[model samples]
Target: MNIVVILAPFSLALALIGLAAFWWTLRNDQYEDPQGDASRILIEDPEDRPL
Candidate 1:
């Protein structure tokens, strides 16, 4: 069907874009602090305390 021809390329383009974004994050060390973020939630900021 004609729809398949159009949809196939569109889907492939979306997949490629997602892959590129993932690769960019890898090269930028965006995932280096995976555990830091999780533990950070348990830590409180001193500025947030009631005076």
Candidate 2:
């Protein structure tokens, strides 16, 4: 019973923080280029090759 009093606000604060971060990403266009990013990781660049 007492634990709920302490945990409820803490949980709500964490949820709000997560939501804010998600909103920030949306405003910053961070979600763009999902497929491009996925395909990009598969390519091997010459600079990454062993010396």
Candidate 3:
């Protein structure tokens, strides 16, 4: 019963931190090229190969 008091606020704070991080990513356009990276691997570029 005493643990709940400590855990509840801790859990809420953790969730808020996670939400803040997600919001930061959205504002920074971190998700803009989601598909680009996935499809880019299918192409072969000379720059990516070792000389």
Candidate 4:
């Protein structure tokens, strides 16, 4: 169908774009701290200075 023909390329392009973005994020260490934030919340804050 004409719709399929038109949509297939668009879908493929979107998939390729997504893959490229994922690879770029990995290369730049975008996901390296997945648990760091969660663990930070459990840490106690240091004593506060007197006002």
Candidate 5:
């Protein structure tokens, strides 16, 4: 009863904060190179080895 009244607004605020952060990331192109990073791991850089 009383606990729900207090907890509901708190939970909703947290959810809104999370949504804002996700929206900010989208506007910043944070996920643009998702596949690039994954595929890059499989690539070997020749310069990394010493002759």
Candidate 6:
């Protein structure tokens, strides 16, 4: 349909935008350490005493 022609470019633009964001995040080291946060939870904070 005619709507497809209009919507396809918009959808493709959005997809490219998303892919660019993903690439930027990867290049910027946004996902360098996936497990670092999980392991941090196992370490107890010394500032948590009854206050």
- Candidate 5 lDDT over 1-51, as tens digits, reads 999999999999999999999999999999999899899878889986569
Q: Write the per-residue lDDT of candidate 1 for residues 1-51, one digit (tens) a residue.
A: 999999999999999999999999999999999899899878899986679
Q: What are the runs in model 3 whose C-alpha is more than 4 Å off?
A: 49-51
Looking at model 1, the pairs that clash are none
Q: How accurate is candidate 1 locally (lDDT)?
A: 0.95
lDDT of each: 0.95, 0.96, 0.95, 0.89, 0.94, 0.91
Candidate 2 C-alpha lDDT tens digits along 1-51:
999999999999999999999999999999899999999888899886779
Model 4 TM-score relative to the real fold: 0.69
Question: Model 5 compared with the native: what TM-score?
Answer: 0.77
TM-score of 3: 0.78
Candidate 3 lDDT, 1-51, residue by residue in tens: 999999999999999999999999999999999799899888898898878
Please give the distance, in angstroms, between residue 50's alpha carbon in candidate 2 and its true position after superposition: 8.8
Tell me the deviation in Å of residue 3 in model 1: 0.4
Residue pairs with backbone atoms closer than 3 Å in model 3 (clashes): none
User: Comparing candidate 4 with candidate 6, which one achieves the higher lDDT?
Assistant: 6
Candidate 5 has an lDDT of 0.94
Q: Positional deviation of 15 in candidate 4, in angstroms?
A: 0.2
Q: In model 3, how large is the Cα lDDT of residue 45? A: 88
* Cα-based lDDT at residue 21, candidate 4: 96
TM-score between candidate 1 and the true structure: 0.82
